[model samples]
Target: MRLQDLFINEDLSIKDAIRKLDETAKKILLVTEDKKLKGIITDGDIRRWILKNGDLNQSVSLVMNTSPKFVYEKDVIHAKEILKDKMIEAMPVLNDKEEVMDIIFWNERFSTKFNQQTLENPVVIMAGGKGTRLEPYTKIIPKPLIPIGDTPIVERIINRFNEYGCNEYYMTVNYKKNMIRAYFDDMEKSYSVDYVEEDKPLGTAGSLYLLKDQLKETFFVSNCDILIEGNYSDMMKYHKENNNKITLISSLVHYTVPYGVIVIDEDGSVKEMKEKPEYDYLVNTGMYILEPECLKDVPEDTFFHITDLINKYIDEGEKIGVYPVSESAWLDMGQFKEMENMMEKLGVK
Candidate 1:
């Protein structure tokens, strides 16, 4: 990755920076002023700034870390040393003119070696759907088959799971099942793939019942369109440590109301009035970790949503918990507009 490619102008709005970080799956953004490195802005910096009453309209310079440590062209050796010493994944490389250059990333250059390996978990992908929103395109191909660079969106998802030693996959297919299977079959992939078929168009979480016999251990389920970047091991640890029956991967979504009127008292007297109130809520990221036994509750041959299932669990006093992640950690590429916006944020041509 190149620093210039990842750089965000100092004048860029905080909202734009946030969007960029969310789309690129990057934790930090290099801030530049007049083609010169000014500072580095990290997700943490913006978060702290927001905590301190920073506005979204403010420029990234307001929160960027000035005097950032960087690597020069001739200092490649020192750069590697700096990366190791700092235990950083990547470092911004610069030229003699102090111009931003490429980035040196450890994972990009080295194969990850692990000891005391964790158990391989299975991932269930909800890939069936007409994707009526993406029309015409979905008419020819399924949503999971949509390309995000050169690879299909679902491929990227599976690869992400594979990175954490989750090689087994259960894919639920309905719309264009043959095309999806054919595509994967032609690829000759190493990972094992199991298919779950839906006799009819089952709503989200409805097709999961088809895998009741196949699921023996705790497993993960995710929508094909949403991409979540985080440590899967950490999520699994949280699930098992808490012994939760269902764990939902949630994102802290911030929504600002354009206008706010007034609050009236019981006596018909105006109590309080505020303008443009901002609210925070935990929005489902379409990812979940589920225990095998939970599948027994999923009714057969009926349209059931995951939300409905959660409500049922709650009514039955079953343990259901949410694992919250930063908004930037969740990437949604479902709609065409969001996809275009993602491409811009990722700096893709």
Candidate 2:
């Protein structure tokens, strides 16, 4: 990869650096000035900064790692040694004068890849709901049938799971079910898709009751409108390790409030006043890993939402987990604005 693409000035604010990271699709960046390496920054560094309530407007220099590990281009062998022993996923390569040359990924150097594990677990996609948020478009086609680029949204989601070797899909269809079925029928693909027709509007978890017998093992349930870019293997491992009956995949969402007013006191007096501030929250991405037992709780052919299932498990003291993923790791296409933004980011137009 081009070193210049991963190079950012130390003076760039944390917020702008984040955008740079997203644009480059690299989790790490070399902080440089005058064609030299000043430091290094990674996505983890920015997440930690946010957790510590650091100002997003602060210069990246404030949080960037000054003592970065790098090797001269000629010392590739030595770099491999450091990578193996140090467990570093990526390292920067420098010229004799300590000028940034390029970045090398450990996996690339060793011809290895991560998260390529094939998963045999069945994936249940909830495509039943009429995508009310999408409006007139949903009036013509189902939300899952809505195209992001050339492929439908649900197909994109299934493809991601297919990377993990999840070849069997159980799709719950209701609104515009015929259209969805017809689209997949015409496509020639390796993965096997099985449809579960919802006689009525079975809210989220309610439709999963149909799979109670088929899903005898741990499986995945996801909303057709959302996309998570993280590793499903890691999430499944976490769920199994924690003994969670249900695992909710959540992503960090950062928002800078467009305006800010005064904080009023109990007596209606202004307690404080400040400019617009940023906030971070863990938002559910409408994806889940579920143990087979959870399916039994859903009433057959009845309207029930996933949130209701979660509440029942909570009240019963069953193990439920929320796996936190990076903001860039999730793409929510449920809303029109978000869909447009995602299309733009993916270079759809």
Candidate 3:
């Protein structure tokens, strides 16, 4: 992609910057002042800003990284070296006057042959939940095997990862493990599927320790029943760029209450009453990017959820980040009601 294509005005609001970044599918945005390079705003920067302050109207300059590493028009060789040495997806190409120019993508030049190379990172899917909310259906067909369209919900999750070049998967199974295995075994899949049987139902992150010795790089872990429409490549870029041990893919969920909400003052006086107040919240979409070293903390052979792991890391001051996506991009198929809603929204019978 061209640098000019990725450039955003420094005066643009945080919300606009996010929208543009999502639309462009580029992790870094060139911040320009009167068509001149001012700084670079990355998805990580935006996320960190949001975490620090929930202000969306702030200017991009507040979160942008000034003095970003860049390459001049005549420094193509040096640019490639910097990109490779830094292990970055793309580098901004600038002019002598520090004006926005273009971008040089690493994948477009090198790693072309390996373009078809299945991403080696193992994706650990937490599919052991009993899914009591979906009761009768969960009792028969495992939650992972519940159909969304023509394929099971878990298959869709796997396919979404595969689209971003991930192929190896480790499914943690306990409830109806055989059924889940049988379903996948019967189907012709494009990627490899390996199951880690939990003798007892291990909550989310508990079973991840089973693959501790196997993973040497950052890997993705997700719940089998939620579908999030965001660029995995961008998410990975944000993960590496921020040097985070764990990066959670979050969605901005909005809820509107139909009834009026009353606000009282300190003296019990009515301050105000707002009818049908709408609220926005950031929720974990059950998708994550985790570094290999972090897996060492997963206690062996126990029941623990990923949330517990996150809390542990946060308590220790380890960096954990969240990348926010719009609600329309996330589809939860974990419950009967959500499944019905998703089917209706997706127009899938």
Output the number of the lDDT-best candidate: 2
Per-candidate Cα lDDT values, in order, are: 0.81, 0.86, 0.82
Candidate 1 local lDDT, 1-349, one digit each (tens):
4455678888998878877876666677888766678888776676566546567778887889888778988887786568766756667778888887777666675565322236498999999888888888898899999887777889989988888888899999999999889988888777998889898977888888888998999999999888887768778987898889999988767788899868899999999998888766678999999999888888898899988999999999999977766786777878888777655544563
TM-score of each: 0.71, 0.81, 0.71
**Stretches of candidate 3 exceeding 4 Å from the true structure:** 1-54, 57-118
Q: Which lDDT tens digits does candidate 2 get at residues 253-287? A: 77878888578999999999867977768788899
Which should have the higher TM-score, number 1 or number 2?
2
Ranking by lDDT: 2, 3, 1
Give all candidate RMSDs, comma-separated: 6.4, 3.9, 6.0
lDDT of 1: 0.81
Least accurate 10 contiguous residues by lDDT in model 3: 111-120
